[model samples]
Target chain A: MSESDIAAAFEDGPAFVPYLTAGDPTFESSIEYVEALERGGADVIELGLPFSEPIAEGPTIQQAIVRSLADGMTPVRFFEFVETLAVDVPLVCMTYYNLIYQYGEEEGPRPFVERAAAAGVDGLIVPDLPVEEAQPLRTACDALGVDLIFIVAPTTTDDRLDPLLEHSSGYVYVQARLGVTGARSDVSDHTSHSLDRLKGYDLPAAVGFGISTGEQAGEIVAGGADGIIVGSALVDIVADGYENDLSVEETADRLEAKANELTTGITEQGQPRSERL
Target chain B: MSETFGRYGGQYVPEALMPALEELTDAYQRYVLNNEDGFMDEFRQRLETFGGRPTPLQRAEQLSERYGTEVYLKREDLVHGGAHKLNNALGQVLLAKYMGKERIIAETGAGQHGTATAMAAAHLDMPCEIYMGRTDTNRQRPNVFRMRLNNAEVTPVDIGRGTLKEAISEALRDWAHTVETTHYVIGSVVGPHPFPQLVDAFQAVISAEIRDQLRERTGALPDSVVACAGGGSNAMGTFHHFVDEEPVDLYAIEAGGSSLEVDQARGVAPNSASLTTGTEGVLHGARTRVLQDGHGQIMESHSVSAGLDYAGVGPELAHLVETGRVTPDSVGDDTALAGFHRLSQTEGIIPALETSHAIGWLEEATPEQLGERVVLTVSGRGDKDLETVLEETAERDIPAAPQMNVFSNPTTGGDGNE
Candidate 1:
């Protein structure tokens, strides 16, 4: 489908997306886990390409990447693992710029974008690549019909938002706070303020980071977010499941149950809140 | 000697860096066994020319007189980088060059070791990279600029809490990925394997010099030798040579931050004490005694001195404490700052904030208990701490209550409340 079609789906209701690192613990487990997330409630599945240094992540996601790397996960192998999954949900490849710069070379993200899209990846999240330097990847992704999602932090100013909104296709990623991703005890007031400020933009603004519980997910949707990205908390749930000595299938089942419970509760609660006078 | 204090000093690094640590251990062992011709000559040549060794030993006369004891200071501050850290950096950089390593990578807190490593690497014409926390880089801009001036690439780690711990984590990750030609020159007597041992050996010159100097001046070793324990490198270095000597009493002073009461109340006490309160645990890939929680999660430590602000102590020090070879003591920030001021006033020498903990303990010791002579390791110079000292002094003008005299409070019924 086209970028406009994907953006139009969010107008109906808030999108429920799930993210999992490729090859966490083991490669096959990650594939199974992603498919499980899709089966559970995920609208768009984000598959993180683990790198040695993940500057944008908090401890939970960092630990996942570390475990995946320890299990001999690499970029080439991660892409190959994605290829074998035969995932039904629209897959978005989330990775840092360093891994792409090192592995992509002069031909840049074109080859990777083409290969990834062919393997069923619908979009991408390159957190470190600012809008100015994103033109090369944007052109390549546009040619391949792949949506390149852009992120804006709470600290991101108004002047920076206009330029970013121009190139943004699928949906604008609005970080919940100024800090890195984690399960914060308190929701950021700035998240709603930032979303309201970005309302004039053309794209759907999905709020992420620190959105853990069903209550929080429902609140974001109530506050006018098009989608809520629950990353670290879900990764923490998967990590906790692994610690229980659960088999890959058992771990996937437990994580999917958690995602389903959280998303279903959010949607149910969200409907009543929005229907109220 | 088995080259291990316990299970603590064995090689526990990634398989890639095992050979280098082993090679360093082997070369150092061989060098120690045979004082071959030109061994000391080459070492001294490098020391005089590169490291600027044989750092002077000063006597803190006025501070000693105030406490009614004789105190002599081993001046590690006189080295090239204004800190004792250069002693290990110079040795490691040379060894890396000797082993045909093309690049040097190190981690730093407060930027002392980073600047020192950058200096050594620059002098040797080897490419160097130092990882420092973004918070530290902002706090220690002078040292960060100094490292950059020396042509070392400074990578600010903005991850985790963005402190020394995070910097070390980043350095370790970088080293693991580029282990082929990069040498991770660890800053302290921490990490796995020969690092703690190797760094101690290089820094052992501190005590070896103290032994010779004491014998020449007094014709005998002092009753007790004291030094501060950060990673326990300087303390271990000064104490290792005298461990077997029955007459010498060894002491490793730890940073108590504000007070033991404050730390204990806040549930942050253990992290403050590197040797005294730390327990057996693992951190930064090393099995050692660390100030951690029940689940082995490293706790936060607070100290006026950034250098001593770590949760873990060196493994060798742990073994030493276990064997009763050394006694551990904790000194509060007030006493340490007083010690810093006293040393500056009396000896015309400045001590690192880490070393002031040792000096603070000395200030509190009884004259008779201190005996005629006491030698303490003045681990690093206080130039880098000028800003910190001035800032702290401005914040608190009152002199610290006498540590010993506070115990004689009449209202508390001699229960030590001041």
Candidate 2:
């Protein structure tokens, strides 16, 4: 899909991408969560491939990962679930490099990129695979017609930006904050500056890393971001409501309600959503 | 900066961290490597005034008698903080200060590195946080208290068997969010490019002094130089200098927890012997010998010494071992403890459990293998290990595991020396 296609998916505003951790609580719940996200008007679904060591995530997502792994989530198991669930939206596989490397079985007969592409994965984002060492995985991803997206942080230098943008596809992940991915009270102050710097690049951009509320989403869209990535806040809702002993349908209802609030906030023009909330 | 170790190191990190890593690499190059504007003087002065440089190479008369050779102990344990960990810690803290960073973060396994880092941060008046595996925090209690006393926040990580790798992941996560203000003081010669090389240069002081001290004692280099390898920092420090000297046999003793050999019948994971029997894989940013399952999932390593329990060996050690520059050896739990007791009884020196691996190897080495005048590095003191050693010795039955037949194996010792 082209950048314009992604832009078109988010009619009237920036794309609202909801990231769901696969196999949270149970494998079935993960599918249900994604379904609810789609109903709440998610333009793109970023499926988190839970890793044993997720160094790029904060406590909220880390706990989700721990829960996912406890449910016996492995690389092969993740692909099997993706194949079975078969979500209709643009599905992106997000995880650390080790999982892809392990699942790829570098020495084994088959690489994971092949298996993921065959299983209907649309894009790939290994947070730990730098542009310097992405050729092998990129080669395999290219052959399988899978888009390999790259992330550019606020701390990224001017010289390094071009290489990352050149290699990225299916919209680039522009980190608004300097830290790991988690919901913050407000978006980073440097978000506007980063977006302005990235404006020159032809690629469609989305802002992530600590983007919490609908107001924050609206601000990012106003700042020229093509999409808004929401992860921890949505994941945290499921985690917080988990102890209340909700059924699968009830869980999806609660999650969809929260997703709708975020979706509405992104489409509306105003200050960061936290202040409005 | 490229992440590779003579075909073993490469930067396999995320693009999000590329700018930070490159900036760090450039800072390291400008300040430490290039010694831009006399930066080395400040680093060296700190090592001298704060770290107590030129640690003694004490002659072990009783140990020499027992081993039937002249044995000299490179006393890194005598350095401030009671371990060689401070050498690397002090240098990194200096670099962080040079970078104008106010907050410092690090990951520790045995808490020695954490205490050393905390001490450096304290001296420099920087706020410090250390990520430690809960298991290690519980095992090495005194060091935990020491880090706290120095005002460093000691967070006990409770994930994935609660070990070093888990602590590292936590530190890495913390670093990702606060890349500009925070500096990570990685404790070993592992990880991405410049880190492995940077850490080794800081640690190479162990060998630099040994070269001078050994010549002063024996008028020539010893027949062999020995040190224990965990992430292989101290061993890398001790072995790196001797690699070019063909006749000086470089030996690295890794922890062999229950046994080095894998029990196919019993279906047990082999002890923490990475070079002995491990495949080449990427772990903790460096492509090195790692104890991984067939599918490349990192295996949990077992050792009596928590300091030597890592599944991955240092990349330089991996390359050196591959190129026949360093001979890899193993010392199991029971024997390492036995070596600990013997050192205390005979030499009046209570060696750290990690350091005892080298002492244990000496106990079994024939006169033919370990020639006259051997230098052993006591990487750290044993005060921190007394509780675990006493408890383990009290609770366990002593059934001695058979040592591997290393003498017959040409590949066991580096082929170039033997």
Candidate 3:
């Protein structure tokens, strides 16, 4: 899988994307959970490379990251986890910029991007890296035939949006709300407005942040998102199972069921409003 | 005009904060640099009347006799809030007002910056809140009370060792959620672009005053200037005006807590010497020297003083140390405790534990190393450190400590020191 694979996944229809920390409960359990997502009809799987400080995440994902790091997850182990997963869909490595900046002996993004390419990872999503300081990483990802995805907040102005569109590859992560990543009970009205802002850009727009349920995912897709990215919703399931002392098979079953419900909603919507019109 | 110090500083934050940083950058250019709408003028005037600017540069007669040199103290301990923290806190709160912000938030480790920011917000009539680690709240109880007295809400962070780093992460999280109507007053010269530059510009007043006062006292600048480095605010302020002087030297003393050795298995470094033993990495929105493990995870840092217990240093200070413009050194906890007592007993001026790190370095240096004339910033008063000093001094065999048994039975009836 590569950047083209991710772009192609969105071309067919509104894609269903799910996220999980690479080593949330443990390394072996995480691989099974990711494979379950693939079986549940995921188009792109985002594997969180847990960073020590995840400033962009809210309570749910932040707790998930802590659990992952406590399990002794590292950059080397994350790449090895990526290589071990059996999913055929595009895999995106999501983490903070420090892990990417301090990867190898030499400092910069190239060494990490190079390693990601070699490790069979398809894309990179750095939540803490703004578009203004993303040129080096953008160039590196482009050179290595990987995709660099940028998140677009509703507050992102034209000055920032222009550079973001120019630099972003694979897709643009359209933030569904104003705050950090978390599971919200209600869908934000800002999702449609955010997608409207990205109408001029040529990249696929995947709405994320606070989209927790099948109904919310369906509403975002029906409102014109090219895809829907869900994180905290799925991570909550894993955390609940871990706390309840559930077996790996039980947790993986819940993940697959949740992923199926989300993808079923997106598929039931048939097509995005923009694609239909 | 540039946001970076060499290749060190940049705005490495989430997209949600980009707009806020951009607005702050514009304000920083107009009000801070260009002084538009008399922003800098009002800032200076307020600092003078409210913060008590131009703190005395007193010649330490006893220290001069001990070191055989003309040792001077930049008396920032006399500042209104009892530390140099107000220089940046008041400046930022004023800047937030100029930017039309309605609320103020900040993070603190030792509670000094929290107290300063709280006072600034109250003086300016802006609603304020401060985030501090739960561990710090238990230790620095008096300063926490001072912040509450100023009417600022103190939010205790209960994650990841409950220290400065965790407090900063919590503050950043709040700023991301409230960036539209609130301003985050970062306590140190760390963080992303505009913050390091903004905090440094406000703190530069310390050096600016030091240079003028020293020139008024003598005819020339001192041969060397020394200040302790946690996030390197006071050190940067003390060294900012003298970086161009070819003859003057700069020293940044760090807290060498139990040892310099990093416990890789536990992911902890027993010291907070980022400028001396840290690797270049990104932390708290800027790329700087960070105490991290081989896997790029920021390690837990420790210090006797909460103010100096941080895992990362300011980018500008890291750049200066990298370029050989400033010398990096460290002193152990016991040595700093002795220095704390040495100053109190000899000069009748009790210094903060963080400031004592610099004074402790003096004992480790030779006469030639300090040169003929030396100046150091007394960053804060030791009132906030009385409890910490009492506890830490009791555990160690500090020659300078008077007598631990004097206060051993405070609750019950006890005899005098005699």
Candidate 4:
């Protein structure tokens, strides 16, 4: 599908993106959680691939990776889980470049992307891959009709931003701060400034990191973001409720409630059709 | 012991290193059972002629009288190059030669292990490289200079907290890339499999010597053995040989940092005392008990002793504690400093701050509890720690004390002066 087609899916309302670590708590929960995220209002779901040393995560997401690894999670297992889940949401496997470099050759990203597309995934977001290094995967993703989303941090210079915007498809991920992803009491003022600069570009822009509550979702949408990405906070909720005997239904319901809270506020306060046109 | 003692020690490492760890484990197991080829004899010959072994066991008579219990010091300080670290470094280097590797690499914090590795590599006439944290290089300039003097290249690691942990990561990354010609000689018993076991075996010579020496002197085994645990090679080595022997109390003391309560709450919060606070987790490709949160992030641990500052302990030590083979304890930085001063003032022996953990435990052993005898592993000499001692003493405003004139008054043979 083209960018316009994906944009059309969100024309009726503001898009919701839910982020969760793959194989978190357990692989089964991650699969069910994605479906639950979609059902509750997520137009796209960012599935995080856990890494042993994540240089870019705060304590909360780092803890999620640990919990996932402790439960026997690996990159291979994560891809296999994605293949089996068969969910309908646009599954974007989000990860650092190290995981891909470590395991992508043996289990090629093309095959993984094809299987994910067959299993209902639509894109991928590799945070650390710069435009120079993204060509090979971008070609593979283009061949497979899978979107390759790139991140633009608040620190990205104008020279870097233009090329990133030119190469990016699906939606641009706007990091809220210079630091790693985690819950923070306040978002950076630079995020709003970056969003304003990104408005000139004709791609959908979503704001992520440090956005947890409903009020923050409304604020980001009002500030001109096409969508809002909620990650560490929602993952923290699921992780906090994780138990040895947690059923799939209970986990789904819990995640759905979180998704509803984030999406409802964005939809209610987002730009109306008249204002955008 | 729960297959890994609650996720603390296991094979959570890269696939490339697995064969090496397996080979090491097999070699160690065989060496322990039957030294049919006189491995220990050759090892001892090297120790005496080069590395130095059978370092004197001196009775701390003054401290013994003052504390009302007999205290014997196993002077690892007397070893060549002034610390017990060489015992393991020499052994591991020899193993590397046996394995037919041409180059050696290692990581060091406070530069002790780097210096030791450089010494071993120099003796073996092998190429050596040591990765050290930039922060540690600045603080431990003397040892850093010592490493360079021994002709080892020192790569300063500047990433991720800039400590021993980060140095280990950089070294591992290097080892992964250059696995064919390089042997990564781990400094302590904290890395992936076969390391904890191998280092423990080499250092176990300390306890084995203590066992024989105590038998000859006391005509019976002492009630307990104590040593400091930094990655716990010395403590585990000393404790492991006696694990099967009943009635011998083995204790490993960890740096408690500021306080026990604060350290426990920090839990790998970048302070030492891995056994007391670290949970089952993986780091540096080894499944071991680590001070980490629910998510696999490494925690910050605190310690006054630079040598003891780490986020994890040895897997074997964790296993020993889990199986009730030994007891682990913590002593704060202040108590360790006090122990250092007490040993100096009472016995004229300046102990390493890392070894002061063992010295501090002496306070817990009452005269009745210690019974007639006790032996402690004085893991390293205090030469490298002179600046640290002076700095700490100055900060604490300790009274100016007179230096004992042992060399001038030769009649007393430097005995019972304190």
Cα lDDT tens digits for candidate 3, B1-418: 6878998999899998999998999999999999999999999999999999879999999999999999999999999989999999999999999999999999999999999999999999999999999999999999889999999999999878888999999899999878999999999999999899899999999999999999989989999999999999998899999999979999999999989999998999999999989998899999999999987899999999899999999999999999999999999888998999999998999999999999999999988779989999999999999878876776667788877565555522223222
Model 3 error, position B88 (Å)? 0.6
Number of the predicted model whose lDDT against the real structure is largest = 3
Tens digit per residue, CA lDDT, model 2, B1-418: 4467676877766566677778779888899889987788888888888999989999999988878889999999998999999999998998988888879999999898999999999999999999999999988899999999999999999877888878988888888777778889999888877788889989998998999988886789989899999898999998778888899998999888897766533323457888887778777666788876644556777898988888888888899999988989888888898888778777888889999889889988878768998999999999999877765664444333122224454332232223
Q: Predict model 4's lDDT versus the native.
A: 0.73
Model 4 chain B weakest 10-residue run by lDDT: B409-418
lDDT of 4 by residue, B318-375 (tens): 8788777778888877678778877877777888889877887787656764666777
DockQ of 1: 0.02
Ranking by DockQ: 3, 2, 4, 1
Instruction: Tell me, per candidate, how large a share of the native contacts it keeps.
Output: 0.00, 0.64, 0.70, 0.00
Give the Cα error of residue A260 in candidate 4, in Å.
34
Error of 3 at A6 (Å): 0.5
Tens digits of per-residue lDDT, candidate 1, B1-418, equal 4646765554433332344555666655655334344454565578778777787766777766776666888888888898878878887887777667899999998788999899989988999999998878887789998999999999998764567777876777676445557888999898766688778877888888888888888788888888998888889888978999977888889888875542433335533686777766556646567765432334567788888888777888888888888888889887888888777766777788888888889867666557777888888888777767655654554364223333443332222222
Deviation (Å) of B379 in candidate 3? 0.2
CA shift of B78, model 3, Å: 1.0
Q: For residues A153-201, could you state the per-residue lDDT of candidate 1 as single tens digits?
A: 6556566677878877888888776556678777889788988898777
Better of 2 and 4 by lDDT: 2
- Cα error, residue A48 of model 1, in Å, equals 15
Tens digit of per-residue lDDT, candidate 4, span A1-277? 4463345445655577888988887877777887788877887888888765554556577678777876777656776787777666667888654445334334234655665566556778875455644676787778888788888866566767778887888888887765566777787787799888897887788888888887889888888888889998888777767844567788779788888988888988897523574
DockQ of all models, two decimals each: 0.02, 0.52, 0.76, 0.03
